[model samples]
Target: MADSFSQAARAATNELRQLFEPTPLQRNDHLSAQYGAEIWLKREDLTPVRSYKLRGAFTAMAAVLAQRSDQKVFVCASAGNHAQGVAFACRHFGVTGVIFMPVTTPEQKIAKTRIFGGDNIEIRLVGDYFDDTLAASQGYCAEAGGHFLAPFDDADVILGQASVGVEILDQLGKEPDIVILPVGGGGLSAGLTRLFRETGAASSFRYVEPFGGASLTAALAHGAPETLESVDSFVDGAAVARIGALPFETLKNVAMEHVILSKEDSLCATMIDMLNVEGIVLEPAGALAINALEQIKDQVKGKTVICVTSGGNFDFERLPEVKERAQRFLGRKKYFILRLPQRPGALRDFLGLLGPHDDIARFEYLKKSARNFGSVLIGIETTSPDAFEALFSRLDNAGFVYRDITNDDTVAQFII
Candidate 1:
């Protein structure tokens, strides 16, 4: 089975050359130095569609076309990389493709998908959420008799994603000591796991998932795939509520300890660092594996590690939010509610308590809680994380009442 799978992967990879060359597997010096390990990145972000989704989309579409040469239409629902992948594949195959995306999807993504598909694909703005868009697309496919292309669930899609593992082994010329992969719906991780196991590679694996969308972790816990009650969509590319059934079949044996749940905000710091330091732009999902290194640096030190930076379809519009989240995660920024006296100089007194390096980023006055007191939302930015301690001490010494709501998600959602 291993040999056969390897052969199939090689074949798919060879066919993929018709679309684009193999994504780079470059050794990263900065990351290597930072982690005290030899760190290499499989640059899937450099793909034509800026993601690995194209590999699976093209392979799955090719397989369908091979079986049904008369097939004229393909259908998929995606707001991001998958939509772009399918659109590109449709144009290459000269087939009519219907790409369904949520109505709330960013115009940038929608426009990019349209540009990829050209005249061969039609963009359908359907539901407000992905689930609704998915259901609508399936119904449209069934009604139109068009082939439905799943993002990660199908066997062919898994086979296509396995090609990444093939490329990794071939490019590295030797097995890595460790491979850290970002997990979304499990297709990429499952495919690579199967390929490595089949090839008998000695490398161990660590799977990284966004903390809010930890379907793989949940699956490992429940002994089967389970839908998350709620998923944070910040890591939009990898925020899958449920792991794919087909992929889970291949990944069911993975140990719970091998999985790492990365905080969503921490990923912003990784993204910002890669962009500013390495000049690499990455989406939140793409930063998962790299961000996870901080959690396992002790174990990976002195070893050859490969981290797959998954996608780079980032919208610059979100840069401010990313910076904010990154600062919050690093403790360089904070938000708090202060109970201030309504009397004169109260604001001045509060401002005077701040450290010299502290800068107010936001100061909004909420309604008055009493005749002499009022609630003020304040956001502070500082040069160092430790500055907050001194500032808090000063606030305490001044007999000021305050609530640190920086990490309070409920209050943050409402105010921050």
Candidate 2:
């Protein structure tokens, strides 16, 4: 069964070649050397839509249109890379599309989706959140009698996403010892896993999810789809509250030990690493697979491992925040609430104790506590991690009362 499924996927991928060239299977020297393993990236980030979402959209749409020629209208709701994939695929198929996005989506993404679809699609700015936006799109789809394309959850969509796996096998000329995949709504991972199993490749598998949104891992543990109480939306691409039903059905049997949770800040560090070292821009979700390597280093060393850097639809406006997160993760930067003497020479004395490389980035007087002291919030950036240690030690020696707020989510969200 696995061999036949793999064979069918190959045929599908071959047919897809007419649509676009194969995404690269580039061996990354920096990552390989860092991990002491043959680390190859499937480079799904280089696809036409800068994501693997396009492969599934194209395959599913083609199969559907071939059967129902009159199904000319398609609808989908997405606030990120998936919308662009559907828009691009809509234009490719010459079908009319309605894309609904949350009002909170950045103008840059909105513009890019419009540019990709051109005259073949319409953009709808719906609710403030994704769930509401999706509800609106579903209503519109029912009223207009169009097919609602799920980003994941559908078997056909999963089969369509399987094209990535098919291409990976073809491009590499051999099977990898392990494959690390990033999980979002689960379409890509489900499709790839099914195809690999069908191909008789029990390649060791590792699944990465954002620390704030480990839906796939959660589902596998519970042996069912489970909704998270709350999800952090930092890695917007993979910030799903729940795994897709069909996806969980296929993935639930995988061992919990193989699923890894990537902290958002740590993912930022990898994003910075890829951009600086490889000149490759990756969205947070795209960095998940690579970030998992540090945790699995001992197991992957000297093995042929492939990490699927999922998507590159990164918005530059978020670059500053990414950098800040990276710095925090690396421990070279910090924020704090400091209690200092209000006397004129007190501020000067505090400044004099700082290391030469320590620079104050932000300093705001929060409140006046007493006649002799004031509360201040300060953010510090340093050239080296040890600079912070030196600066903090000096502050302690000087008897300055301070609370480190760098990782304080509640305060950082409002002030940082």
Candidate 3:
């Protein structure tokens, strides 16, 4: 069964060459040295759509058109990468497509989708949330009798995604020691795992998902796909609330210990590291696999590892926020709410307490809680994480009262 599936996946991949050539699989010395392993990156980020999503979208659309030449319309709902994939496929096939996206999606993404689809697709700005957008798209597809292209759950889509595994084997010329995959709804991970297993590959696998969106972890624990109570949208590309039903069918046997949940803030640091040290720009979801490496560094030592750099559709507009999150995670930056005496030279005294390497990024006087004291919110950035210890010591010695609010999500959201 696995052999037959691998053959089908290979055929699908051969067909995909008409759309775009295989994305590069390159060895990375930077990560290799950092982790004491031979690290190779399957650069899906280099795809025409800057993601592996294009492979699945194109494969599913082509399979439908091949079986039913009369099928002239397709529909899908996506806020980012998938939308672009479908749009690109629609244009290539000369089929009419309707894509529904959340109203809050960035304009940059919307424009890119429009460009990819050209006149072959129509864009619908729907509800503020993804679930609402997906419902609207499905309803419209049913009414119009157009084929709805699922982003990951469909069999054809999964088969399309299996091509990634095929390429990894072909490009590397051998099975790797371990394959680290970043999981969203599990199309990519499931497809690759199935293909590799069927082909008799000896490669082990590690799955990575955002800590705030550990749908796979939840599903494995519940013995089925389970919807998360809440999801953090920070890693927009991989922040899925539930794993796809079809994908989970293939991945259900995966051991819990093999799955690694990456903190969203730590992922930001990975993104920054990749950008600064390796000159690779990765969105939060794209950085998931690389981020998981730190957690398993001991195991990967002296081993041949493949980390799929999933996507590179990062918006430069989010760079500042990414840097701030990265700094906080690295302990080189912090936020504090200070109660200071509302007397002359008090501000100067507080400023004197800061070390030479410390810089105030933000300072705001909230309000006077008492006649003699005022509440102040301050954000400090320092050259080293250790600088905070000395700065805090000085505050203690000066009789200052302060509350660290850097990790206080509720307080930081409102004020920071």
Candidate 4:
């Protein structure tokens, strides 16, 4: 069965070539040197919709349409790359598509979906969360007698996503020693792992998921698909609450130890690194596999490894937040609450503690009621992590009372 599926996936990949060339499988020199390994990145970020979602969308639609000639209307629930993929495919096939996205989804993604689908797609902003939006889309599909397209989970969608694995092996002419996959709904990871196994490839697999939305980990722990209570939407593309049932069927036997979790903030650092060093813009989900490389550096040393950069639909508006998060993760930035003596020269005295390279990014007095001292919120950024040590040493030597709030998510959420 797996062999048959692999053959079908290969055919799907061939058909997909007419839609867009295989995404580049380029060697990343910077990462290779850093990890002491041959690090290659499968550039799914360079896909026509800036993601590999289109592969699954197109392949699933085509597979379904191949069997039934009368189905033309398709509906899907996605606020990110999947919507764009379905929209683009809808336009390509000249079919009507209805996309349901969360009300809180960024306007940029909505606009891109519109651009990809053109007149072939109609997007409707529905619920505040994906679950609600999904329910609404399914309800509409049932009511209108339209075909419902799942983002993942379905066998056809999984087969479509298998094209990524097919492309990787074809482009590299051989499988790498290790394949790191970013898991959301499990479509891509399941597809890749199944294809590789069926083809007798001996590559080790590492699954990475956002720490805040580790549905795959949770499912592994429970031995079944499980819904998370809450998910941080920062890594919107891979932030799935529950692993898809069908995808899980293929991924069920993956050892739990091979799955890695990446902090959302730390993931931003990898995004910054790729953008600054390689000029590669990656969405939070796209950076997951690369960000997780640090966790298994020993295993991959002196070996050939591949990281699938899933998507790059990054909005420049989030650049500032990404940089700030990256700096915090690297210890190049700090935020603190300072209790300053309410005196004429207090501000100047506090300023003297900063090193030459340190610069204040934020400073706001939180409380003015204390006649003896004032509570101050200050954020400092520096070029090197050493600057923070010097700045803190100076503050300690000067006997300044302060509380570092940089790592306090509760307080930083509002102030930082």
Which parts of model 2 are misplaced by more than 4 Å? 1-3
TM-score of 2: 0.97
What tens digits encode model 2's per-residue C-alpha lDDT throughout 317-396?
99998999999999989999989888889889888988878889999998875787898999999988888888889899
Estimate the overall C-alpha local distance difference test score of candidate 1. 0.94
TM-score of model 1 (CA atoms): 0.98
- Extract clashing residue pairs from model 2: 2-198
Query: What TM-score does candidate 3 reach?
Result: 0.98
For model 3, what is the alpha-carbon lDDT of residue 174?
90
User: TM-score per candidate, in order?
Assistant: 0.98, 0.97, 0.98, 0.98
Compared with the true structure, all predictions reach lDDT values of 0.94, 0.90, 0.95, 0.93
Candidate 4: give the clashing pairs.
none
Better of 1 and 4 by lDDT: 1
Residue-level lDDT tens digits of model 1 in 1-416: 34477778889989999999989999999999999999999999999999999999999999999999999999999999999999999999999999999999999999999999999999999998889999999999999999999999998899899989999999999999999999999889988998999889999999999999999999988988999999999999999999999999988998888999999999999999999999999999999999999999999999999999999999999999999999999999999999999999999998888888899999998876679899999999999999999999999999999999999998899898
Local lDDT at 251 for model 1: 88
- Summarize candidate 3's per-residue lDDT along 115-225 as a digit string, tens digits: 999999999999999999999999999999999999889999999999999999999999899999999999999999999999999999999999999999999999999
Of models 2 and 3, which has the larger lDDT? 3
Output the lDDT of residue 243, model 3: 95
In order, what is each prediction's RMSD in angstroms? Answer: 1.3, 1.6, 1.2, 1.3
Q: lDDT tens digits, residues 1-416, model 4?
A: 34587898899999898799989999999999999999999999998999999999999999778988788899999999999999999999999999999999989999999999999999999998788999999999999878898988888889899999999898899879999999999999999988999999999999999999999999989999999999998999999999999999988899999999999989999999899899999999999999989999999999999999999999999999999999999999999999999999988998877778898998899999999999999988899988888888899999999999989999989987
Give candidate 4's TM-score. Answer: 0.98
